[model samples]
Target: MNLAILDGGTHYHREAIYGDRYRSRFDRAIYAPDLVLADLEDVGLLIVPDRIDPVLLRRHRALLDDFLRRGRTLVVLGGNEAETWVPGVDWAFRPLNYWWWLDKDAVPVQQLVTPEHELFRHLPFADTIWHFHGILLPPTGAKALITVPGDPGNGDLGGALIYEDCVTTPGRLIISTLDPFYHHGSHFMPAATRFLDGFLNWARHIS
Candidate 1:
């Protein structure tokens, strides 16, 4: 599938993570800082890194709204410490270097949170674990298939549906504050690869 990785404005670690996790699965996964809102085509899926600039956010918002209307999947990873053109998304994740999650017990990666959703196919639940800080949305029409319980430091809480079969007429919106792919790509490739397999499959299946 054709996918695009929009790095609104990123740091070093973010690049490393995207490279390790999503390097090959996509027919093409590019990292561009100058990408405009109107530059998007039928990219099937879009991964927006936390590098989004606030100044440009206003301009890109309309284009992104349009993209979601077309049934495209927009995945936002939480590794960044910047603003996103995509608004209203609340990301849940912990820093890889944070002391709160230093121990494995602090944040155990969940295999199955919402199995009923189509995003959980061929997933090696038992063998995989992920490190996420804060990646979550308001749960509007977007259905959250799975979620990691929240702790004082990290993890995501359950919310309303974020995806829609017929979003805004001809276009459908698939928004996810979950950045498992980003986390995996940055630190654990095996987990990231496993998650991407499911993530990509889910993106393609949505309207």
Candidate 2:
């Protein structure tokens, strides 16, 4: 696949976790502020990682929408506050459950809302189970892939860890709170690396 990754350009966490991997794996790595529509030419997949410059993204929003209209794929990672830039994603913060796994009876799981989804064919659900930044209510007509398990009728924002909105645009839009890029780059979460390896494999196989 002719993949392109939008670099956020921060020198701390983003650089540590994504710099090397993006440099090695993607076809093009464009800095967010420097990104222009021309950079997306021939790109089959575009990845907008977390912590990107919102102003720059907004400035290029029209171009991104146009790119999607061409039936390309857009993968968004880590945007709890970027709903204004993204077409149909809305975010909500949840109390971080940092110690959920520490409980003896705790079952820290990310329910696969779409077990039959193609992404899962490449990645196991177990690899996606990890702490998230927050939950979000996906745009209308979006298919939720993973979600926080909660009472069915409760108004809890268990949050969707992974979701996609294909109806909002001509192309597929996958958004996630799963910050695999950061986790993998920091060498903190092994599962994140495994998840990303599978994700990249899936993206490459798209014809």
Please report the candidate that would top lDDT against the real structure: 2
lDDT of 1 at 61: 70
Model 1, TM vs. native: 0.59
Worst 10 residues of 2 by lDDT: 11-20
- The pairs that clash in candidate 2 are 17-185
Winner by TM-score = 2
Measured against the true structure, the TM-scores of the candidates, in listed sequence, are 0.59, 0.86
**Candidate 1 segments whose C-alpha is farther than 4 A from its true place:** 7-22, 29-31, 50-59, 79-111, 126-128, 135-137, 149-190, 197-207
lDDT of 1 by residue, 167-204 (tens): 32344444543445444435544555566666655554
RMSD of each: 5.6, 2.5
Per-candidate local distance difference test: 0.50, 0.77
Query: What local lDDT does model 2 show for residue 196?
Result: 83
